[model samples]
Target chain A: MTLTTQQSKEAEIGKKANHLVLVVTNDTIDKVYPPMILATTGAASGMDVDIYFTFWGLKLLDKKGQTQTKIASVGNPALPMPNIMGMLPGMTAMATKMMKGKIKKYWPTIPEMMQQAKDMGVRFHACSPTMGLMGMTDKDLIPLTDSICGASTFLDWATDPNSVTIFT
Target chain B: MLGTSLATTDAKPAMVLDTKGLLCPAPVVKTSQAVKQIQVGDVLQVLATDPGSKPDLTSWSRMTGNELLSVTEDGGSPKVYTFLIRRMK
Candidate 1:
């Protein structure tokens, strides 16, 4: 069957543009959100998306991480409670529950978003060097992770025309 | 200009997706999925309530190479935004 003109144009455009890459460097609830949001958005935009989790970022991929949402508030400027109060026991969980309540109506939860991102073809990469430092294995992370890779390897893949690479 | 205008003014939509009460990526993501269900060159009309969905869907369509035929805003208070997009791939 002959391809329609619109379909041909789409194929041509897809051929011209490469994927978007995001480097996640932190695990704190607030910090982890940026990369997740971008990866999810990139997938929805019909762009291939890769998120490389390194250092503390890898913690987010841990099965324990996404199971419970906790926002680090000790130094967070956005935290409504006092810094001293943030250090109090159970405050982090309280803050996390509050945040979850606020966002439940308007957005998908972090774990739900992660599943959706995966369904939309977003790739998650774990940093090998960081895993070695943290004494972790593939068993520690969620099943969505695609690879345990080095920085240079990902950098090599990221270098291209019209590719969006972000570090956060 | 002629082609764009023709597309914007009179391209009849093949499907309508109602995304009211859905927010941010939901509306945009739903539009993305809805576009895939139609044939190439067929228009998909999306009704979204999220204020952020317009720019998000606009940029998404740009990145995906889909044709954004028109965006019409309805009502004044708590406006309803309508997007008409044609499937390309």
Candidate 2:
């Protein structure tokens, strides 16, 4: 295709700035919230938001995992606890479960959140290397994933001046 | 002995940011957007309920170089936090 001078100029202006996000997580239930929250807000703020799901983060792309994501609470550092009680074991899992319940009670399920992200035109990218390591195929991921790419590709997308590279 | 009390008042333009019923990132996100619309030296009042706002707003103020005048509880709701922010150019 050939581009006219005006068209090329407009394209350059449009490409001058954007926001990019890298969401890396493997923490089961609570893992999906950070990326989804940040990406959705970024889009709302008139920025281009790209989410790269890799390694354990890839679990968020799994249709099955989306239905069962939960928040950890038992031993979560973020949770307020007495100094002596904070040292208990298995607290994280309990906290995760508690958090999961709280979230489910208030917001939509992870699957619904994924669908909302898709509806909002957020770009979801699955990590090709992670897929290979985990023995997952493209078909195993949610339909929202636009492509499977590498770190270099993500870095390139984040090169613009207005781009805010966030690791959620 | 008798004592008398005196009352004093000060005038300043106040801005309101209603972030109630919203969650993390939303409150901060909305607050950031609202702050952009005000002039330097203007004061903004933000109402929110997200437990994360304390740190979020604090950090946002520090990073953006704005002034956080105060953060107080609203109507006794542990989650209902109000912030007085002074816009800094």
Candidate 3:
């Protein structure tokens, strides 16, 4: 076959392969939602989805952290309030509550979304080195945790030629 | 916009999903779940109030290889979108 035909054939194959890898590196509620949303929706769309949680994002793998994640009012340009207002004692809590209220009105809670993702076969990867850094054990992680792995293993999973990898 | 297929426009749906008051990804996710309960070649009708569902469901139906048979819009206090999707696989 000609080079042009071969390239077109390869593109056709790529279009048919459905795999998604999301690398999550932040723990703030705003950051957490993107990867979780993508993972759940991607899996629902019949794609194989893998979410790798590292650094601050690893906190979400634990039940306490999931329950306690706060929305970042300070240094958030998207927030309509002044930065100094965010520094006030109750602002963060208020912001978190307000956002969660809006989110819950339209979509399922974070825990519910996680449960749906798990039910749909989306894999969750906990960063092993970060686990050691945080001094967390497997038992401390949520039941949704599929594996504790390093960067290299997660990278290997992202190396599929037909897969799409995202960082949030 | 992807126009309704002439042949399937009047197709009877096997199930109906109500996603009123829900937004964004929820409608698409629920529709995906509803689609699984039916046999291939069966149609699933989805009713949603979120304006975003128009484009979202279109893209979803295309990505999943499910045929979007028809889309109807009704003007109201909260606009309603009705989608008829057929499971192709």
Candidate 4:
């Protein structure tokens, strides 16, 4: 290929490769799938993927909390009515318990998903403020956390021109 | 109305990923890895379950600009889901 042609080809290749995504989730089991799925896909597509787990989302980092993460079905209009009917008075609490069972039946445990995310080289960040508020220390979180930072720190990573920020 | 199998097959399948018994991130994760090995225009066949794969595949295909040719259930295993994906370079 000629020099100009080669340069054009290189530019074309560069354009195809540019992808950056920032996923922020607040620990809702049902809500966690979006960010995890998006981040995994981004990394798979050769894009730089960063996931910022803040507030309740940070629970994924907690070894115990991750395995015990529950889905809130009460007041969540999305829960199937048939399933909701099974929950009596404290439906929210019952739904959470039932949802957890359903989730466990369908897919890998949250910790396993975390391992997969790490294996895919997806960057995992835990929010420091949330950690403090929840009274959780680094010892409580998964060992793979890239770092603990505040919202401003996450914003710095999300400001790139190619970065697509998503709040889940 | 036409069956999903009859849509089109002029292109060759570039990769085949068997994600049976795998859940959520595994299917997408494996598909992503498989896509990396093929060039644009190549197709990838993914077989998975976990229900979440449907939306996951659609969203990933849309996000990566890949063509999701088809997604069907394989009968042997009641939960089997298959996806035909064409790489978009």
User: Top model by lDDT, which number?
Assistant: 3
Q: Per-residue error at A102 for model 3, in Å?
A: 1.9
Per-residue error for B88 in candidate 1, Å, reads: 2.3
Q: How big is the positional error of residue A84 in model 1, measured in Å on the Cα after superposition?
A: 2.6
Q: DockQ score for model 1, please? A: 0.41
Q: Each model's C-alpha lDDT?
A: 0.80, 0.69, 0.83, 0.72
Docking level for model 4: acceptable
Candidate 4 residue-wise lDDT, B9-66, digit = tens: 6446767788877666778778888888887667788888678989988867765656
Where in model 2 is the C-alpha error above 4 Å? Answer: A1-17, A70-94, B1-20, B25-89
- lDDT of model 4 at position A148: 84
Candidate 4 Cα lDDT to native: 0.72
Per-residue CA lDDT of candidate 3, range B1-89, in tens? 12233354678999999999887678888898999999887889999998889998987876776777789999787988999898876
Residue ranges of candidate 1 with Cα displaced over 4 Å: A1-17, B1-8
Candidate 2, DockQ to 2 decimals? 0.07
Q: Which candidate leads the pack in TM-score?
A: 3
Question: Candidate 1 vs candidate 3: which has greater lDDT?
Answer: 3
Instruction: For candidate 3, write residues A13-98 as lDDT tens digits.
Output: 45775899999898887888888888878887889999998998988887668778778888987888989899899998999999
- The regions of model 3 sitting more than 4 angstroms off are A1-17, B1-6
User: Compared with the true structure, what per-residue lDDT tens digits does model 2 show for residues B25-76?
Assistant: 6676677678878887677889988888888887666545566767888566
CAPRI-style grade of the A/B interface in model 3: acceptable
DockQ scores of all models, one per candidate: 0.41, 0.07, 0.35, 0.24
* Chain A TM-score by candidate, in order: 0.83, 0.73, 0.88, 0.77
Candidate 3, TM-score vs. the true structure? 0.89
